[model samples]
Every structure is written in C-alpha cells, then in structure tokens.
Target: MSLLHRIEHPRDALAWEGDMPTLGRYTAGIAGEKFFRAIQEHGQFLGTVCPICEIVYVPPRLYCEQCFEHLDEWIEISPIGWVHTFTLVHLDLDGNPLPEPLPLAFIQLDGADGGLVHFLDEIDPEQIFVGMPVEAVFKDPAERKGSILDIAYFRPV
Candidate 1:
C-alpha cells in the first residue's frame, strides 16, 4: 500500500512529505536575492514599479503581470504599510501545532500599489486591524542569509 494510504488525514500526509527535506538553505533567484539583499544589507525595502501602469509591485519582480513588460527599476518602499488581511496560524506548515500561535498578515505598503504577505510580531492578535500601520523588521546586517526570512517580521512602526 502507498504510504499516503496509511495516513488518516490528507493534510497530515502532505505535511509529512513536505518535512522529508528539512536540513538545507534554499537559494533564492537573482531577483529575489536583490529584493532581500536590499532589505538586509541596506535596511531598504524595495519593489518593482511598473513603468507602464505606474504601479509599484511589492515582493519585487523582474516582470509586471499587468504590463507584460520587464521591470528594471528598483524603488525604495516605505516600511510603513497598512494591514489588509490577517490570520492566526495555530499550527506550523508541518501540521504540528505550535506552542503559541503566529499571526501572518498581508500588508499594503505605503507608496506601493500592492501588498506583501509576511509574519507580524510584537502585537496582540486582538489588536491587529485592517489598517494598522506596520514596518518591516530586518535582520542584523552581519547575520543576513540573502533570503526573505532575512526580514525577521513586520511590527508596529
């Protein structure tokens, strides 16, 4: 019988498979490195701005979906942003319940046309709101790993 057939919950089966490879640093692509590096090394959060539509894309991209054009301009975005949506995750991605819940949020950064999803810290769940002002918390420069996780999490400005 397949290993999945022995599992009770489909979610749990998937989590077990996902955790099979858990001991390595995953490399980000060039664009992703550029974005994370800006935040880690320079303490500057940046995004790709669509020159055609004039819309700033957070989670910086090399191409614009709307404009269908390559974006080469990197603009610094204000760390301040408003929380658009949020959720309190009681379990980790591996399906193991965490000792404490973590609150993740999609924040629409200031001066940008869209939002980025990341974890939020230093605030109570009940206090989180749709328009709460928050800022990115970057990892110490010397400890950076050129990954999105380099930004520890977002917190109240």
Candidate 2:
C-alpha cells in the first residue's frame, strides 16, 4: 500500500493528518546499561574516563563526543554530589498544592564530569541551596530494577 497521498497543489499538502499511536521499547545502550546495572546491584556509581579529554562521564557513554574515542576506563565514583541548582515544587503531578514544597536539584557528582537531576528529600526547602552536599538513597538490592529510579532520591548528607 502506498503511504503517501498524492498532492497536486501546495495547499492540499497542508491538511494531511494521520494517527501514529506509538508503543515502543527502548534499551539504554551499552554504556547506560552498565551504569544502571552497577547502581542496581552494587549501590555504586560508575563513570567512564576519556583520557584525551581528561574527563569522566557518569551514566557513562561508550564513546567520547569530542574525539570519538571508545571509552573503556571505568571507575567507581562517589554517589555523593553537591547540588548545582535547585527548585521548590509546590504542586503535585495532579496539579494539587502539596502540603510542603518538594525540593529537587541537579546534582554534580563528585569526581565525575556528569550529574543527575533528581529529587531532594529530608531537607527543608528553605535550607536547600546551591552547593549543598547530598547523597543518594537506593532501594533495597532485591527491589532494584536497573534504572535511575533505583536511587530513590538524593537527601542532604
């Protein structure tokens, strides 16, 4: 069957519409798989080092973006990181006002070049600030599912 509809005039092409309801599955490529697996099983964070760039990638990648070199030097990095920036969320997913503000932050992982944007718990919203040190809280090993969610959230350390 032909997928394209014949269009004789430019204006006819403007009204085309189709429903492409997609159901898809995605795998975290090699590097991400390795990274999450470690987080799930060991409660440790892993990063791949790029010697040429003198950088470490957390939630590691298979190749370096700058030089396109394959990254193989894996290192265990501290799960503790400092908040690079943060926000207070006063509304829930359903748009209801929360009883208390939720703190979330972009945490720059210590000793690695990348970071994770995750929830910040166990701290007052007024006290959460840039550069506040925090650490991850992981689910019990038996409960982990090899995803970023394995780390329940980051909390003040």
Candidate 3:
C-alpha cells in the first residue's frame, strides 16, 4: 500500500482524534540496560568505546555505528558535561502558559561523542546558554528505580 497522500491545501489533511491503540513496554536493550543500570546502581555514567573507530558512545551501544564492530568495553565517565544546546520552556504540557519557565538542555558528556537530553535545574532559564558546564544530580540510592529518573536532573557545575 502507498502510505503517501497528496493534499491540495494544508487544512485538507486528514486527522484523527481519540485515544491511541498502541501500547507497550520499552526494554532499554542490551547496551541501554548497562548504561542506565550503572546510573541506578552507582550514580555513574557508562560509555562504550570503539577501539577501531575510536568513537565513544555515551548511552553505550552494542555495536559501533561507524565500523559495525561489537562494543564490549564499558567505561565510567564523569557526569560533568557541557550544555551543547538549551532552551527555556514557557508552556506547560497542555500548551498553557506556565508560572515559571523550565530550562532544558542537551548536555554533551565529557569524553563521549553523544549526549543526553534532560531537564536543567538549579538556575534561572535566562542564565542558560550554549557550552555552559553542568553536572548530573542523582536521587538518593534508596529512591533509584533503574530508570532515567534515577538521576533527578542536570544542574550548573
């Protein structure tokens, strides 16, 4: 079946509004399980390094995307990273105006090629900027649940 459809006008596009039928659980896969597990168990960040390509994947991957080599070297990386990009969110989840803006950033972890996109806290949204240094703040050991929430948020270092 052809999935593409042509519409003469933007408003003529077909739409559907209702509860979605798609539902399932997301298992973090082999590499992701190791990555998040390290954070949950020890409050540490783990990355996989490719020896041939010499690329470091932050959320460690099972195979090197560049060379297709199996990745088995897991290394602990510093939670410290720099804000590669940032934004101030002034709208709530429902598109309503928020009382205070929320800051979010894509933090490039040191010694890794990729980064994590998460909420930024402990500083004014107006102060956020590119290349700003930040560090992950983890929740208490008892509160961790082997999830991304295990690390509460990233804050200015």
In model 3, the runs with Cα more than 4 Å from the true position are 1-20
lDDT of all the models against the reference?
0.84, 0.92, 0.92
* Candidate 1 ranges with C-alpha deviation above 4 Å: 1-27
Candidate 2, residues 22-125, lDDT tens digits: the string is: 98999989999999989988999999999999989987999999999999999999989999999989999999999988888899999999899999988778
**Model 2 stretches with alpha carbons more than 4 Å out:** 1-19
For model 3, how big is the CA root-mean-square deviation? 5.7
Model 3 global lDDT (CA atoms, 0 to 1): 0.92
Over 22-121, each residue of candidate 1 has an lDDT whose tens digit, in order, gives 6886665656778877877798888888889898888788888887899999888888898999999999889999988889999899999887899999
For residues 15-87, could you state the per-residue lDDT of candidate 3 as single tens digits?
7578879989999999999988899889999999999999999989999988999999989899999999988
Clashing pairs in model 2? none
TM-score of every model?
Answer: 0.76, 0.84, 0.85
Overlapping backbone residue pairs in candidate 3 total: 0
Candidate 1 is scored at a TM of 0.76
In the order shown, the candidates' Cα RMSDs to the true structure are 6.2, 7.4, 5.7
